[model samples]
Target: PSTSLLVDSMVKKGLFDRKENPRDRRSLCIRLSEEGESRFQLLYNGMKKRLDSLFGILSDQDQEDFCRIVDTLYTHVYTK
Candidate 1:
């Protein structure tokens, strides 16, 4: 997989801005554009709202327990 190719495609799509690094001309600095940030926020909020609604169906205790279990699993999987 070519990461640079993917980045170039994203730049072409206007989702990312690529700038030359001041200290290293060979390196390019990439960041999400304003339009990309706006789109990402919209998608994040929509997913969060859907998850909140889905979790709303559970009781408070169940939700707490579910969160605890998820946290435990995350810790187990992510910790070195």
Candidate 2:
């Protein structure tokens, strides 16, 4: 899907607020609304709980290794 379409959909759903950028008239500043923040927090908490439960089946060493692998992936993606 196009980025503009996604942004327009989100704005229509009241999940995001789109404002004209003061410094650049052709640009827009998109931010999450309060409702979006609340929804995101709920989603994050649910995912965290599910991950915790899943990871609980692993041994201490395995869990540590899993975390290390995730950290490495995150760093690789963000630093590229």
Q: Specify the highest-TM-score model's number.
A: 1
Candidate 1 residues lying further than 4 Å off, grouped into runs, are: none
Q: In model 2, where do residues sit more than 4 Å from their true spots?
A: 69-80
TM-score of predicted structure 2:
0.80
Tens digits of per-residue lDDT for model 2 on 8-49? 999999999999999999999999999889999999999999
The TM-scores, one per candidate, come to: 0.87, 0.80
Query: Which candidate comes out best when scored by lDDT?
Result: 2
Model 1 collision count: 0
In order, the Cα lDDT scores of the candidates are 0.95, 0.96
- Kindly give the stretch of ten consecutive residues in candidate 1 with the minimal lDDT sum: 1-10
Whole-model alpha-carbon lDDT for candidate 1: 0.95
Clashes (backbone N, CA, C under 3 Å), per candidate, total 0, 0
